[model samples]
Target: MSSLLLRHHRPFLAFWFARVFTASGFQMITVAIGWQMYALTGNVLDLGLVGLIEFMPKILFILITGHVADRFDRRKVAALCQGAQGLIALGLLLGSGAGGISREMIFVIAFLLGTARAFEMPTTQALLPNIVPSNLFPAAVAASASAMQAATIVAPALGGLLYALGTHWVYGPAVVLYSCALSLMLSLPARQLPLKQKVSLESLLAGFRFIRSRPAVFGAISMDMCAVLLSGATALLPVFAKDILLTGPWGLGLLRSAPAVGALLMSLWLTRFPIERRVGPVLFTSVAIFGVATIGFGLSTSLWFSLAALVLLGAADMISMVIRSAFVQLQTPDEMRGRVGAVNGLFIGASNQLGDFRAGVSAAWFGTVPAVMIGGVGALVVTGLWIRLFPELAKRDHMHPQPNPQPPSAAA
Candidate 1:
């Protein structure tokens, strides 16, 4: 059982460590940026606009980036992107230190950083399958994803503390962390997938056509997108941290991390027992739980109660993520993984930034409390509607993916 997780998966372990470090440092950068922006402008709109500018370029370029991933060496691509991001971090450090931390500079840095992520996310995701044999891909993905969620749990609190110390100093440490990630990438064994075709518009469109042809895949991605878009509580977090909950930066960090802590715990447990058998039903149920948790969170006044609600929301989200990731990876051929992963990344961007925009707009109209509550309810409604609309999702089952299954004793 332990072998199912560790000994046989050495390369994946390296990848996991690299990703965790990268993600944690990025989270720290995020807090530092938000804090700095608010300090500089004292405007909620500025905070909201940061997400917008970052997401725009990513959403625009993600599919093309995915095509590049499928057609090239994913690991090398990841390295190049990471290297670019490291340079950006250095640029940020210099600019901030030079006292050039203006709104325009922030937007420029955000856009450039987002462009780096646009390429980075898909290649990193597509690279996972080649690291482990096909049979172990699911386990590897779950474990790696758990590590990512764990970073979420760890980074924000650490980031808030570091940001509180000083934004300039926080970026310096983040630069070190990004450099460490780059070194790890450089050390990785070369992982390249067979190229079916040169990267082109036709190839990219074909990838979308492939997704459109598969009802299960399409349904899963669509459902997740809508659910996340509706229940995006992260957008309103700074508001809660500052105004509503009155907990300030420390409270803000804890609140941001609570869901991820729940997700990390859930993903860790899932590695031991696969959630493959009833993936369709599981996804729906998990999403429903996510909605309920969000609603509860919106209604709660006490800090502890709100934290608990977000934690439950995170655990439920993990359930959907494990199944969806495994399903997408299993079904996609290596030649197309990058494109598919890119599409998945686009939905993620939509869920995160567009969702934040939605939350911000709604809050502007209905007040923060009502906006969150409505979004939670909207998530619940979307889940049910998708289940009804996408019957294929309801019928999904994990068939024997390989010719021979290890008996339960031998199973990961």
Candidate 2:
């Protein structure tokens, strides 16, 4: 452990462990969901609908959720959300044990899970700055990202293995893990913020207005949204696992873990040697590499080749993610963290869910390979377009927070 992580940051360490348990369980559930749904329907579009069902509540309730995080105790809110997710997992366990799990039941559960995530993500993100010193915040973000990648790397394999035993096995451990996460979240030191005196439409929309006013923040987030929205391939992993690569559930597990494996490596590297110069160009270059790697994965028939491509894809994305996360959180004021995080969460939710929908529809219309390949091309093109559209983002030279160059009035 880095001395930075171990010393003077016991609360942050607890938070990181909470992330591990929560993220591990979530990733495990993801594998179970994708495999079970595909097995039940064997339809690509159905897989896409999985993401859509989960995304709906997130999109609809995001703004309110952000306000709730800001107005209330973020730790308590996160604990409640984590507890709800645990109950949902328990529901899945019971359903699987009864052998009564249906496609509709799965979709309903996914929606409930998405609702929990909607409240949890923004609150959890906003809570970090309160947990660590400002000088160490960037390092904390890197460590946090690394921790998440570690969970991603481990959880899928565990999920796949347990799923191979039985569906109930997957949810059982998930329920336990989520319970642990809730406990850890509750143990974190409470953060006290001034309560909002009044609630109004304008207050709810402050995060939106703030993000819109910050060009660098807006550009980074927009670029990420477009690139990932176009090239998200995780939702379609089952298609590749069973049909394209002819690998079984275990292969699916390895495939899912490969990207995170690369990401974990990159995150650790960043913690040791942070990106200090040409931050904007690094972001753009990393995204472009992500596009090319996606194309490579789309074209590969061999499992090894696909895994290699995915590793590159994940490594590139980690760079982009670290930079973007640090930029958004470091720049935003403490009171506005929840709202800003909500906006960031919305972009992420859109890219992930809508991206899956696009891939499913495209796979249905053209073909899997063509759909993925075309999306990769779109990602590359978006990278170029974003460079042109957000010149200030490209000109940005460092990750440290900078004074706003333009007045709030200049926002359109």
Candidate 3:
């Protein structure tokens, strides 16, 4: 709200707060799922399977969802997705309360939840550009990223503590949060997306073509995928908290929240001073720092040390994320926003959820510390390779700020 760009934009405020609540809801749900799954199976690979299962919806629906976002009404799509997720969360609550929830059932719910997200994420991501003027978008991305990080900062740790009261404590709040998020999305006045080109394979793939022509976007997105695809160690947090750090579910939540604490602080700073120059080099450097932090986290024995490492990496990731997202959103026209955002979301999903799967599998195969440390080294390698391959991203200097017609006359 302190950002000049968002201070008076009531529509974006509704959007922003919905983001906060939605993220808070998910943080608790994620903690509950990971901890409960691990507790039930006591197998490290089950943690990875959970991540892999959640990622399936994105793979199955990726092509169609983006096309849907571009062709359909984004707000309704987003609102509907939220409503579906709310039902899923409510189902989780009832099943758990009834003592009928099983590991397989949890995986089924994760897939359903992921399907809703696959549609909602790109639509909401595209929704922002419509609500805000073009020139202010970098700062807007910063402010919004801060909202997500802020939610992460409080929710996971709180979710963890609440888990002590049982998952009903976690799932119940999530259902309410999703309801609020759904209401906010619905409150937006109706508007149609630019009519998409007639449905066809070529039209469906336009986003893919647009990105191919833009080396910087492709590089930025692919580099993020390759780097995080190795270093995403969140799937192993339950393992770290229980066996390695010798702490309970609360400790796992704190560990999960640590990175967001750093990301939230860094994003707030970025909001005040949006990236203005040498963005390419800055992006590369941030990812490099991420690699170092991951290695540090891998080597740590104490809980505090692990938290510090996670925080540092989280901050580094905030820099990389803000740069990549702003660059992609600004580079494309509004007509292409949904398509491009869908592809962008795909890369993000691969990096986080698939990365977790990779981490989980590696942890199962090589043991935790070695798997993590190796992943960190792999990130550094990817960074060096990307700099060599995508000189455009490294040498890029400015975001090419666009003109704003006036303060957006968004729904009041």
Candidate 4:
């Protein structure tokens, strides 16, 4: 532990630790929600609906959150959001305990949670560069991703155990975890970026225009958006586990986590040997592999086979994650990091939620196997088209430093 701290800032380390715990506790809530809803309703569509509700508010508010992160003291913003999330969880616990928890209430709670996440995520992303030097950004992103997936690997299983005990019980630990996250977030030095101008709708539009101007950033973000939106396999896991795989809730936990296990391994490797060049090709190939793996998972009947497929899918997904995040963070100017990160939250974060909705609706209408398999093939096709459309992304061979933060020309 001491040796690892030698390599990074203490604040960054605390941030990562907080994320691991928060993510794990959050996973518990995720697993508990899915398991509890399914147990009560026994409908796969209901499972998908939960994710849909959870992400909708996030999709709506994330850009504003990103703009806010760019404009203010980020640590305070993070603390406030985490505190909101913790309180929300506590409210959920009480509602569930009342024996009158309806589906509408759950959806409302999910939307509230998403609203909290909209602010929390961009702040977290923007805070990274401030904590670590620019060059260490790649390693830090990879490490942070690994830590997140690592939490995913453990939390779902623990969540399964807690669900087995009782649904209401899961929130208890979650509140504790969120409290810890709040404490860590508060502990960070109050840091704010030197702003070029006050934020406005015009400035927000400029950020979108900036992304449009950069082919690499556009390509990377687009590829990620399409891949997740098309091939959202996790949203279909309840059906896969219960109907296709013939495993119980335990199986659901394992199936959901299989990809994260692979993601964890891949993230570790990326930390050791970061992607240096030809990132476009790396991202394209990774999405292709993700497609193939998702298709294979859709076809598999055996539990272990499906798990293996998801693991492969996860591994491929990690390649995309590292390259895209690195491209976004490394290429963007610091002054625009929060807003750019928020725009990223839009495609990356919103696409994920939208994908969940897509998966849920498609699985409900078309049946599970075809939904996943078709989505996988669509991902494959989209990747091919994107490669041709964004030649700069494919041809770029080197990264360059952005213009440094310049001092004001003169005092007013």
Clash count, one per candidate = 0, 0, 0, 0
| TM-score of each prediction | 0.92, 0.96, 0.95, 0.92
Q: Taking the tens digit of each residue's C-alpha lDDT, what string does model 1 give over 55-105?
A: 897667866788888877787888788777778778877888788888778
On TM-score, who's better, 2 or 4?
2
Worst 10 residues of 2 by lDDT: 190-199
lDDT, candidate 4, residue 40? 76
Candidate 2, 1-412: lDDT as tens digits: 4676678889999999999999998988989988999999999988888888888887899779888888899989999999999998899889888888889998998899999999999999999888888788877887888899999999998899889999888999999999999998888987657555478888888889998988888898889889989998888899999999998888899999999999999999988898999999999999999999999999999999999999999999989888888778777888888888888999989888888988888888888999899989999999999999999898889787567797567656
Give lDDT for model 4. 0.80
lDDT tens digits by residue: candidate 3, 178-292: 9999889877765555754888888788889999898888999899989999999999999999999999989999999999999988888887777889888899999999999
Residues 1-412, model 4: lDDT tens digits:
2335446578888888888877887787777777667767877688777878877765577557767888888888887888888897788788778876677777777788788877878788888788777666666777789889999998887777776677677888888889999999888876667677766778766668878888788888888899888998777787777788888767888887889999999988877777777666777889999889989998999999999999999999888877778778877777788888777877876567778778888888898999998889989998888878987776666544337698889976
Question: Once model 4 is optimally superposed onto the true structure by TM-score, how far is the C-alpha of residue 221 displaced, in angstroms?
Answer: 0.9
What's the true lDDT of residue 132 in model 3? Answer: 72
- lDDT (0 to 1) per candidate: 0.80, 0.89, 0.88, 0.80
Once fitted onto the true fold, the runs of candidate 1 whose alpha carbons sit more than 4 angstroms away are 1-5, 397-412
Which candidate should be chosen as best, given TM-score against the real structure? 2
Q: Per TM-score, what order, best first? A: 2, 3, 4, 1
Instruction: Tell me, by lDDT, which candidate is best.
Output: 2
C-alpha lDDT (0 to 100) for residue 1 of candidate 4: 23
Model 2 / residue 183 / CA error / Å = 0.6
